[model samples]
Target: MNESIHVVCTHCHAMNRVPELRVGDAPSCGRCQQPLFQGQPVALDSAHFDKHLKGDLPLVVDFWAPWCGPCKSMAPQFAAAAQQLEPQIRLAKVDTEAEQALGARFGIRSIPTMVLFRGGQELARKSGALATRDIVAWARSVIK
Candidate 1:
């Protein structure tokens, strides 16, 4: 029997069951018919955050604001990290400015904070901008 994993759709927030072997085959959401992993960080708001957090794959979320210099500088690196980390991990972004409640809920006191979650629980958190390599390494280390 093939093992399956639950991946939340980034576009529609629908839950999807993907065979483990086909995770890298570019799976699509059953409800919305959108690609499951788009190779980039998905922009999330409070409405869709909880489902993504509860997915079987680990979730890496960057809490950032538009005016923060470090956050601006880290956007490209975060995007690049998404390319390297998807299928195994889901990378997402929450604009703190637009989602103040989420930021507050996560106890984010600083911009450019990256939080890793698994099974709807926070596994680890880091505060600062990280290079693409560092982002991948940090997430991998935490998940391991």
Candidate 2:
């Protein structure tokens, strides 16, 4: 049997399986029928966060808050990184203020922190804001 990839929908929190070779074709979720990668980071709350964590793709989350300047500055960079990193990775954002429990659970001490997860495991983490290239490089390094 050919290998398959498990992708959790950021739009509807649905789990989807796609053929490994077809991952570059912009697959949609079977249940929600939404594109799995939208070329942007998905905003997630605590309730929907764990669903992506369970997926097969590496999950890169930007933990940020509205009141933070650095977080705001990093938003566009994160979005650009999402456009560059799709299919191979899933990018998301969690509002620290809205999801305090998740921030605390991850021991987030600063705004604009990024955490990378795969197979429900924390692979790497970075704090503070970074440019799009840096984000892509860091994620690719961790994946390799």
Candidate 3:
């Protein structure tokens, strides 16, 4: 038998169990019938952040604020990283301006922080802007 993992839907934030081997085959959410990974970062708020953390796939969260220049400059690179990193990993963004509580909870002292989580636990964190290639490389390295 093949092992399976829980994948959270980017659209409805629903969790779906998918076979490990079939992850690349484009799985849909059982609850929402929507694609699980859309090659774009999911916009998350405090309400839905923990739910994503429960997923088996690693979650890379970009904590950012609108007033922060580096955060804005890194937004596209993060999104591009999502396109290259999805189906195996998930990328999300939290607007610190709107979710101040979350920023405080995560100890976000600076903007454009990338936090990686697996099984609802934080594994690693990176702060500052990085190019799309660097983002991919860093996430992969941390995951390994």
User: Relative to the true structure, how large is the alpha-carbon lDDT of every model?
Assistant: 0.95, 0.93, 0.93
What would you estimate as the lDDT of candidate 3? 0.93
How would you encode candidate 1's per-residue C-alpha lDDT over 1-144 as one tens digit per residue? 999999999888999999999999999999999999999999999989998887899999999999999999999999999999998999999999999999999999998999999999999999999999999999999999
Stretches of candidate 1 above 4 Å error? none
List the candidates' TM-scores in order.
0.97, 0.97, 0.97
Give the runs in model 3 whose Cα sits over 4 Å from its true position: none
In candidate 2, where is summed lDDT lowest over 10 consecutive residues? 43-52
State each candidate's clash count.
0, 0, 0
Residues 1-144, model 3: lDDT tens digits: 999999988888888999999999988999889888799999999889999999899999999999999999999999999999998889999999999999999999988899999888889999999999999999999888
User: To one decimal, what is the Cα RMSD in angstroms of model 1 from the true structure?
Assistant: 0.8
Candidate 3: pairs in clash = none
Best by the lDDT measure: 1
User: Cα deviation of 141 in candidate 3 (Å)?
Assistant: 0.3
Show where candidate 2 strays beyond 4 Å: none
